[model samples]
Target: MKKAVLASALSWALLAGCSQPAQTDQTIHQVNSVTNSSSVSDQTTLTAAQYSEQFIAELWQLYPEYALYVGYYDYDDQLPIANPQRRAQELAWLQQQQATISQLLETDLTDHQRTDLSLMANFVKRGIWQIESFKSWQWDPSEYNVAGGFAQIVNGNYKPEIERLRTILKRLEHVPAYYQAAQANVSKPAIPQTRLAIQQNQGVASVLGDELLAKAIASDMTEAEKIQFEQRLSDAQLAVATYIDFLTELLPEVEGADPVYRLGDTVYEQKFAFDIQSQLTAKQLYERALADQKMIHGKMAELTTELWSTYFADQAMPAEPMAAIGQMLERLSQVHAKPAEFKAAVEQQIPELIAFIKANDLMTLDDDKPLVIRHTPEYMRGYAVASIQAPGPYDAKANTYYNVMPLDGMPAEQAESFLREYNQYLMQVLNIHEAIPGHYTQLVYANKSPSLIKSIIRNGAMIEGWAVFAERMMLEAGYGDFEPELWLMYYKWNLRVVTNTILDYSIQVLGMEQEQAMDLMVNQAFQQQAEAAGKWRRATLSQVQLTSYYAGFSDILVLRDKAKQAWGEDYSIKRFNETFLSYGNAPVPVIAELMLK
Candidate 1:
């Protein structure tokens, strides 16, 4: 699951009835009784699928933020409350439902039916862990930020201005209770998380006071409506401000306390199983990443030697292959975008890349989908260089923002290095991953899937893997001249993903400090100083997430090769991607079973 969306699933209504932690064997038999007894269209199978679908949809109502993300506006006005009591209730209900779903007679369910049930099971397992096991409610302050409650309102125009604002105001009324509960429940706030929450709350206040209400919500309101809107927003600002103050006040108490951010091996591995649903364990994934890292480095070395001969045919070759590769890449760095032109270059290249995809039939081009490029929200920044804040699977018309953070405020040397790393060729690769045929394209198809279960229970590895795969696919499909320079840059980008897996496992599990971590990223992966530094923070703030790109990308590549061997002449990139992604964002292994079998 994407961290933001799942953590955002905080709602009192969502957990209202989860206190019922009991499931009977007969209830389990509904799934058990269905399997080979009927075809997919048979009454029994459809009955089971529909039953599970309804259960999944109803659960969506509990998370309004998630609803908005997915484009379901039914709960737009509601905000989720996070406290010990509600979490306990939600956890219990999840356990009961999970027991019933997990025990469904495997013989009775169709392949698709089993996949949906597995998706549900994954969600329940993660929910149980997040609540009872991880207990982030007690320490992760970012969990309590209501800014997202406001963001959902302003970010989407699924409803008219007045209607959306009214709904937002209704949710805003609960802002105080939401944060108050945060204060109550997060009795031991982690300092790093607390600092982030404070920063995020201030961002919410600015958007609410300086932009949202003043500009959009009350932009053209009647005098009477304006007064009500202003009052509601004024109150929201106070509640958010109060929470920010609490986090700020908490800074002193945590000054000497340990950071306590790593999930440790035990919790992190359990999370990997639920989120990734892969054949490999964390250790296996990390070891594979190490091998893959060396392999990619070797390829880059060979390619750079070719480039070195092209430019310096008269000179003696460097004894070490890495030295030659490093020098060649350094020269390629000069070909990057100027700081001022970085984002625009990315924007300009997208349509060109999409045109290429369509012309080559590499993948289907759905021109109907809407996309935009903009600065990332303050609350969402500090995680990655670029990311897609796409509308959830349910909402198609809403614009999927390709968030590109500006490097202006960064130290001059850092800014230049960051941009150079996102060089002209690399920007196109990043665009391919974050937009076009990457997250945006896959997500658009995911939205159209018959099952919402796949969308809600997003497998991080699958989502990231597809994006990483997309980058390679586009380059192989003949993007940007298929030149040695471009391919070398592409290898660097892939290296970043491979090193990401090794680096994260190294830091969080092996407890490798910054010195060693930096060496792995900079020396081994050849990442920029600025990029490596950002990843260190991101890895600290998150665990098991960075590894998804390598794990998912490599797994899907293996799946594609098998499909190629099996389909023979029928194997086309377009066909494979469509059939594979058609199943939605369930774990790749689940998709593999359905597609490969």
Candidate 2:
């Protein structure tokens, strides 16, 4: 998952969702009535269903942006000010929720209720850790942007144009105060994050610009109302500009300060637990990745030897395994779509994947939900090349976007290197991971999940791991007609996952530097220079996220093996997949416990 603005804890979507909850009559009443632990404690006597509903209501009040993200629109016009007072409030709410969930877990309950309660407890503990221990708000200025929340409202079809515009106008009123609070909260900020804040904020006006203005003007609202909306838009844009200026000016002041981006071993351990939620500890996961790396290299070498003559019949192969595999991949990568045809190629593969899933009876495919392919939004660029923007469970009717970054303006060499990295076979793997039977498919099932807790408190490891698992699963089920080239690229892509764990753990906890990191990616993992450069940048920008792929993928594959043994004659790929995903996006371990039971 791509991080969004204000994701101080875990991924961006995880925390940004908390920043934008809406306010309806029910929410306002809940917020006002539930002022202390006593009020929430009273709800514990209620049934699991009742208590969960009440818990979500209080949660929305605390993290309103999250409410907006999950399709609750009551507080769309409100933006939580990231000031000291608000953090204290969040701390108190989390402690109370933690207490209530602890008590609930002790009660007699069904499997589903227990699973949901456990997830809620995990979510609450993470929030508490964020406030008390991993306090990113104090040093990460990039966590303060407001453009994404507004962009969601502008692009969302949840409300009509005029209504959404009105929400935007009301929310825009707080832009100045929001940044004021942000500026006040930041202290000794990380220089790298400060620079990123400047770049991300520079595009804030896109969401508040002509497209929104045109909608407001065309709406049936009064002329005076339209004028008022335009004025607010201008102010919001200026607030964004002012915030960018603040970050730009603050850069030099902190350039020579301590390098605080590295979350040392102590904090890294705790963060990995909360974010990945895996059965293994950080050290164990790192060790497993190291072993997987050697094994994948061996597999890639075998494929390279088999295909060497097919691509280079007249040439002699390198004596070293890494060199031989690298040369073979370089030849295979030459066959790729042009930069202009990148997005079109991705778009064209969606239906093919859907058909394969149906023909093979892999899993049930939902046709009602539409997947819209588009360019990555301006404010969300500078991170990953592609991501999925799925509507929250509450707004299931809204379109799910497959966000591909356009290569239109990239330098020609950079674009070619990128295209070669994606290549033809790997591009199909990318589609499988990002679109059909991956994020888009998995997320659609999440929204349909009956348990609200499972759908909303999504685990990044499971989310990412499922995508990685889907890639391997598709190929094994006869995707690309069992081509060795596709398998070679698949192994190469899988190596990326293994090295991602190694790169992240080594850098954040073990003090790995740029040169060593590049050697691992380009020379060892066989990634192109362009792809390696992006991963290096991304590794610095995030922590524990890159590791999610291997952590989750390995855990999931192990779980499936146990299921096969336990289910015996009843085990089938479709049966295993549907049952696994049925738990929504709960952590892999949690899902495993429930599944194996």
Q: Which predicted model would earn the best lDDT?
A: 2
Deviation from native of the Cα of residue 230 in model 2, angstroms: 2.1
lDDT of 1 by residue, 115-212 (tens): 88777766766777666767666777766666654676776777787777677667767666776777777777766667666766676754576677
Off by over 4 Å in 1: 1-46, 215-225, 252-260, 313-315
The worst-scoring run of ten residues by lDDT in candidate 1 lies at 17-26
True-vs-predicted CA distance for residue 208, candidate 1, Å: 1.2
lDDT for 16 in candidate 1 is: 16
Over 410-446, each residue of candidate 2 has an lDDT whose tens digit, in order, gives: 9999999999999999899999888889988888898
- True lDDT of residue 97, candidate 1: 61
The clash count for each model shown is 8, 14
Query: On a 0 to 100 scale, what is the lDDT of residue 257 in model 2?
Result: 29
Candidate 1 whole-model C-alpha lDDT, 0 to 1: 0.71
Q: Which stretches of candidate 2 lie over 4 Å from their true place?
A: 1-12, 15-33, 253-260
